[model samples]
Target: MPTELRPLGVTCNIQCHYCYQNAQREAGNMGGNYDISKMLQTVDQVGMEFTLFGGEPLLLPLEDLERIWAWGKERFGKNSVQTNGTLITKEHIDLFKKYNVTVGISIDGDGELNDVRWCGNLEKTRTATSKTMSNIELLCESGIYPGIIVTLHRFNASKSRLPRLLLWLECLDELELKSCRVHLLEVETPMQRQLLALTADENIQSLLELYRLERELHHLKFDIFQEMRALLLGLDNKTTCIWNACDPMTTRAVQGVEGDGTMSNCGRVNKDGVDFSKASEQGYERYIGLYYASQEKNGCNGCRFFLMCKGQCPGTAIDNDWRNRSEQCSIWMRLFEEIESDLITQGYNPLSQHAVRAILERYLVQEWTKGANPNLLRLFLHSSATSYEREVMHAYLVENNISHKWSQGKLAHLDHHWEGE
Candidate 1:
């Protein structure tokens, strides 16, 4: 969990089309009158890792940035920030080490891939990307390796372009960049909706292939892949922040604070001066209840992945007109299939448990009808029914009213029910 502080609100130098906070900036809502002492007090009250965030947090005056960094380190013992990497300096790098600030730079990739994030003009964007990469190298030279955040878009998700993007990341890995967060482009604005070219299926397939390549190459690591792997190994609760006792309505796992010292839901919704936590209480709960119930009633009640996906990001779900699922549902489903198959290959049969089997029959099998892989089907069939398994299977069959008659010996005949797979 982190306390996300927006010191200057949405005032950034670069105009990234996909940025969700652009509306606030356009509305002249850049925060600058924040009372630092009170903000620090609120951050202390939260007692979590502090994150300095904004249109570009580094754009804040050097003294103010240093003061916030000092306070965060003194009170919370660690601090971090996400910046565009265009404004960083040698002095900032020094302060980063002094205050234990973990820097996360937002860059899509090298050249035109990154120039999509405009810097007022095409020529400026080209110049900025070069300087941004230079600053990244400087950070590495000073023994401070920064994490990269790549916001995936249609252009970057193409089969040819995706591998090239990976190669660029591999070069960064050589420069000692160790981590990256690969985010799917969220169509939050008209610009995003128009510019985003990749479909849900295309993005998922590209990302899944990227995961496999990363595994084979053993170079850089993606945060999403790590989380997925953690889920597969049953270490999800221990390793993943979002998976641990997260009641979305009440859980302030990531609290977004405004410049005027107001606490809000998160950065995306809060930049508009909305106190998201207070405003969304009833709305969030209602949406959650209705959405989950509908999913269960429709079939998800039987999905083992339900608990893991948890219907994806509630915000993203709402952004897509409260569709009862994440827009990235295709990506998540593919990821789970890969992870589950990997676990089986490693001799862990997730379906051996009656609980898993019961859930699988409800929706996992049916959902696979559209894109069932032959090899995965074999993995699903590999579980040998023990005496205990026989009892569980028989009970599941009767509870679901799956009419196939089953005795102790012909349990494997259940394959007939799963025809398309």
Candidate 2:
């Protein structure tokens, strides 16, 4: 099913250094008025799952939220809100239950780790966080699962810091957290670059340490940590990693509605080439039409994982010099290889084989199903498919008469059938 993320362009109370929203912390007002009636009508027209995100969505008045929930329930069945958790109150919790809103809270970790950007008032954050914990408990008690979004920064990557974060989560009394998502801070703009810059060595070391701990916590009950562990252990290859940008299942069907109510293919690209204010003056549909018309001509044509990534976050692509592969791709590949080597050294033959098969199967499925465009497929196959087992794979394909082609750079197609399948 397609999912639509509607950015409310609202301001927030806290000033997080790494926030991508560019929200005004003091004014705490949305960029433009959010017309609930028009928004609901659009949701009904699209018939897609909707998510509310903002400078801080909770900053919106509770009555506005209630109206949203009522209209949303009549049109879209499920909805979610991503928030920083500082503004949650008992009334907010009740509204959540009334709307059946799935909650995702953004918190780095323990007081120390979380204090990195939650810097306005240490005592207030502590108080707010404690209250948020209670809210989470209330949600869980009410049978609503809540997820945590943790952003890893320079300090949180330290060997000592990671363990402490884990311990903190274990300590929370009401934290039956359903998931914990960890993401590296992406610094793209010059202003952002100045605000958040990490040395390459620091980044590498942090990733390595994170991967090590991830391996140690593989069987955790929560979803995020388990997924990270699986990724570290090489269990979450392209096939199993549902969030792999290449996987169609993980792709988000987003419509970017800007401050002035103009729509775009993706909100991430709202800052680029889109004149939302003008479009809003004209009509929302005009902007959407322009966006759809420009979609085919944009990025993802020559990408190796075009089928999988499908030009992820146009804003991210533009910000990162239009590179096809994301920064996380290299880290993931390195971690996978490291785990594979460790498995071999430990004499875990079956586990190592399974890891290898997972990687290969994903490659096979992508190439065979025409999931990846030919040029990208050729590069991946040529660079990685160079082993005795790979030769065996080619032989199997030939024997089975699979209607697939091999990369001409390294391996050539067999003229006749081979002995093995």
Candidate 3:
């Protein structure tokens, strides 16, 4: 849960057609309009890993940018920035080296493949991308290899187009670019009508192909594979945040600073022009109840991936209806199925009944209940788990001397009993 500082908020120079923040940015609502000194103080108070983000963070004044970099370097050993790479200059490259910043530049592909990332129009997009590639080359030549961030859409995610994109990535010889974060387009209300948005099926297709390509290219990494590989290898600690039951209300680890020095629930929480920080303050308690209620309502009863997926990203929950799982549910399910198959081939039983119980015990019983009182055993256990599976869980509990009383077809009064066991 890294802190993201959006100095300019949604006010970017280029308008990527599929951007979720377009509505806010189009309304001329730049976020960093708050008291800079207060914001800096807040940054110092919560000194940890900082991610400098923006409509475009580099669009901020060089002095302001330098202040942030200096603060991060002094407090934390390293920092990172996510930029479109259009505004980068030679001086900025030097500053990156000085602060040991990990630069993340957004680029879908070469020339025509990046048409959706527009700067006024197609011609401007071409020009901007050209300059972006040149800047990336310069970063690599200067021994600062920036990680590429590609937003997957119909424009660049086609089976035909992805190969070309991979080829180009490989051509960047001196670039020690290890990984790229592939963002499936965030299809919010405004982006629904955009032609660039990929359908759920298309999204699955693209990722399936990407996984195949990922296996071939050992040198270049994709973060999704990294997570999956970690999970498959039983190195769950290295898995991504997606695997964790990250309660947004409680954890709220993804903090965003509004332009007015107020804190937000992250950049995507509000897009209807309401100040998210203020809104969150007013309704945080209500939100906590709402989220928990949603989880109970949905009741991960039949979902085999409940432990690892935990209803997936709350940000993409259907219409922000936390009651439903993420809109990307189907895509993620398909990917997980593939990964599970691979893990089984390698002699790992990722989907074993024992594994499922472990997920429920750790994520649900421990994290949610804190071992004070046991709850949600009925909701956590998939209805599809065979009787043998139940026996396995019961036997394991008995062997470990964990006390529990079964009530109303649900396990209750669970406690670790060591005195009389």
lDDT of each residue in 1-421, candidate 3, tens digit only? 5677876667789988877676576666656564667666667666658788877889888787788888788888888998999999998998899898989899898788888888998889999999999999899889888888888887787666767766776664236677787777777764454677777888888888778876666456778866654443333444455554444443355667655555666544444645444333221222223234444454444555555565665556666654456767778778878887876676555532344445444444343443221223333343444456556555645544445676565455455322211
Tens digits of lDDT, candidate 2, 133-192: 666667677776677777666545555675776565554323445456666665555765
Against the true structure, candidate 2 reaches a TM-score of 0.62
Would you estimate the TM-scores of all the predictions?
0.78, 0.62, 0.79
Model 1, residue 299: C-alpha shift (Å): 8.7
Q: Which ten residues in a row have the lowest lDDT in candidate 1?
A: 371-380
Go through the candidates in order and give each one's C-alpha lDDT.
0.65, 0.50, 0.65
Clash-forming residue pairs, model 1: 154-198, 302-359
Error of 3 at 222 (Å): 0.8
Task: Pick out the ten consecutive residues of candidate 3 with the lowest summed lDDT.
Answer: 281-290
TM-score of decoy 1:
0.78
lDDT tens digits, residues 255-296, model 1? 777687777655433324334453443223322343346453
